[model samples]
Target: MPRSRLVFWLFFAPVLLWLLLLIVLPHLDLLTMSFRGENDYGEMGWTLQNYRNFFTEPVYWLTFVRTALYALITTFITFLLAMPVAFYISKLARSRVRGALMILLLLPFWVSELVRVYGWMILLRESGVLNFVMLKLGLIDKPVEMLYNDAAMIMGLVYTSMLFMIVPLVSVMESLDDSLIEAAHDLGAGKIAIWRTIILPHCKPGITSGAIVVFMLALGNYLTPNLMGGKNSLWFTEQIYNQFIASFNWNQGSAFGFLLLALSSLIIWAGLKLTGQRLGEVAS
Candidate 1:
């Protein structure tokens, strides 16, 4: 057999088996559990009641709708902000400067998410640094309550998800030929026209792919929303967590997990369509 085939068998086969044992099998088990109904001692009785609760429960659907809207808005905002940063770093920054800047962009991932979220908690609190600074600067007489709200959750989401959006966009943008933009300029096209007619078309895949990744993550995140979203913002993942760990309702938790999985699939599918993926690309 070929060396490549030998390597695949040696390396990839074990990983494939591990995935089957761990991820795929567990996910399948969850699917089975989702079809069951709640029972005494937190056990499942095979029925469709768990799935029925998702649609019929007003609170469940409300949380779902709210989470979806937040995710969509977060994804769009992250893309809009990250695009210029990625394009600039790829096209304009010097090689050494790019390394430093990229590190700055990715530096937060070095810390735990809990730590980062708590850091935001300190910053956005009434007696926090922002309030003190604004007051000292005579911008405001009193501290604004920036903590414990949807706006705070959005800030946290944007901060955490920015790098995911930036990296993919940069990966595609760095490969772009600068001469094409120059050629457009040479043809007497204005800056806006060149960006709209040329650069936008070339970077569509990166934009779509990055936004999808960010959106899925933001939608499913429990930490940021629960910590920053406060009592007012009812994120759906918190419900899943409560059902599984707090209340020990495994059936309901599984149903919630399946709903999240379905939502993620829909968003990813839409992204693939918008990005114009080929058949082979989708398959592989």
Candidate 2:
């Protein structure tokens, strides 16, 4: 047994080491880099200026808060919409059609999110498909500006994150016993009562997990907001990208990245605490 345990650890050790080297080491490097950096003349020194700049800059803080709020709104909307769809997939779908429907639901995953977002762009932009359709319908003589707005940003986020929310919800819901729901119904529980009392409590882990994933992705997103929201959106991750790529302020960029990491960790912890859950249980 001791020899077997040693062999097992030896096998696992390289994988752990690889993870530490690639992921953990890079993060540590980023933390160090955020504190210490070079000047234009290539002189290096440690400084707190990155954090100072982020806090002191109004646009940086505003974009960060805006991104957080946008992600929150998207997560909430995804939960509201995904629950019923997941339930339908789990409870209402027949075996004959279920496979087909599941495939159809997941077909979008095969398409790139960038492509999907661009499709939305074409549809929402002025003088684009939507405007053309409205013009033909005589709804208005002029095309309304639809893109580069908060609504556009939220729509893009929801579209991007919906699959993440739906898949986990469906996975968790599919395993739930129909008899439990029947028992609730037999106990004179209405649809709302059954949903509130029986369904919500059971799927808390999936909801929590899905929320963390979607929220984290959205909060750190630079692409979707930039493409869909245009100049008006001003997402926080974009600010970090600007710092690193445009301004060549690697220290400030690293600081923003670490700030995002800290915020994401806090959100994940709060979600776990709120749901009183473990992902292992949910997956099992």
Candidate 3:
């Protein structure tokens, strides 16, 4: 074989193997499991009952819709928060300041996600630091319960998902020409006009990519919603977890997982369509 061909195989082999073994094969297994069920004779056979249950059951479908909505909201919120920070680091800050700001953003991720969620709990719980400070400052009559609710869950989701949104935005925004902004300003464009016409158009790909990733992460997240929202967290992933871990219903869990995969894909497709972004461009 040619040297170049051999070198190409050497580099490609690991990635191919990793995709086949870790992604494709596992998904295939789940697909099969999702269609399998036991009949009245107690014999396992192919059936659509697992998928059907998701629709026939109100709790299952309602939770699925609710999770999707929350994930979308979290993605939008994360984008809103990350955009200004990314713009500062990419366009406004000096190199030294940018590096320091990036480090600050990344510092929390050095800890495990579980640890970070617990940190939020420490800050947000009724008897936690936030309440103590509020009470001391006479800001409240009593310790306000801040944890175990949708707002808390959304906060935790945004915190965890913020870095993903910022990194992509920063990467794309760094390539934007400062001259474009200066020229627009010289032509009497205001801040909002500059952002609307120049910056936003330039960052479309990054925004689409980051939004897709954040949405998927928020959709599939178990720890943040489970811990922060507590018993009230009616997330779809929680239902999937209950099916697999608590009830030992792998078929049902697999079905739920596939439904989640479908939901994410559909939402992302719709978003890209609405934004006039092709997946290829976003991926690049």
**What is the C-alpha lDDT profile of model 1 across 188-259, one tens digit per residue?**
999899889988888877787778779888998989998888897989899999999999989899999999
Q: Where is the poorest 10-residue window by lDDT in model 3?
A: 1-10
What TM value does model 2 have? 0.92
TM-score list, all predictions: 0.91, 0.92, 0.93
- Model 1: CA > 4 A from native: 1-13, 38-44, 278-284
lDDT per residue for candidate 2 within 113-171, as digits (tens), equals: 88999899899999689999999999999999899888988888888889889998988
Ranking by TM-score: 3, 2, 1
Model 3, residue 268: C-alpha shift (Å):
2.8
Top-scoring candidate (lDDT): 3
Please report, in order, the local distance difference test score of every candidate based on alpha carbons. Answer: 0.88, 0.87, 0.93
Ranking by lDDT: 3, 1, 2
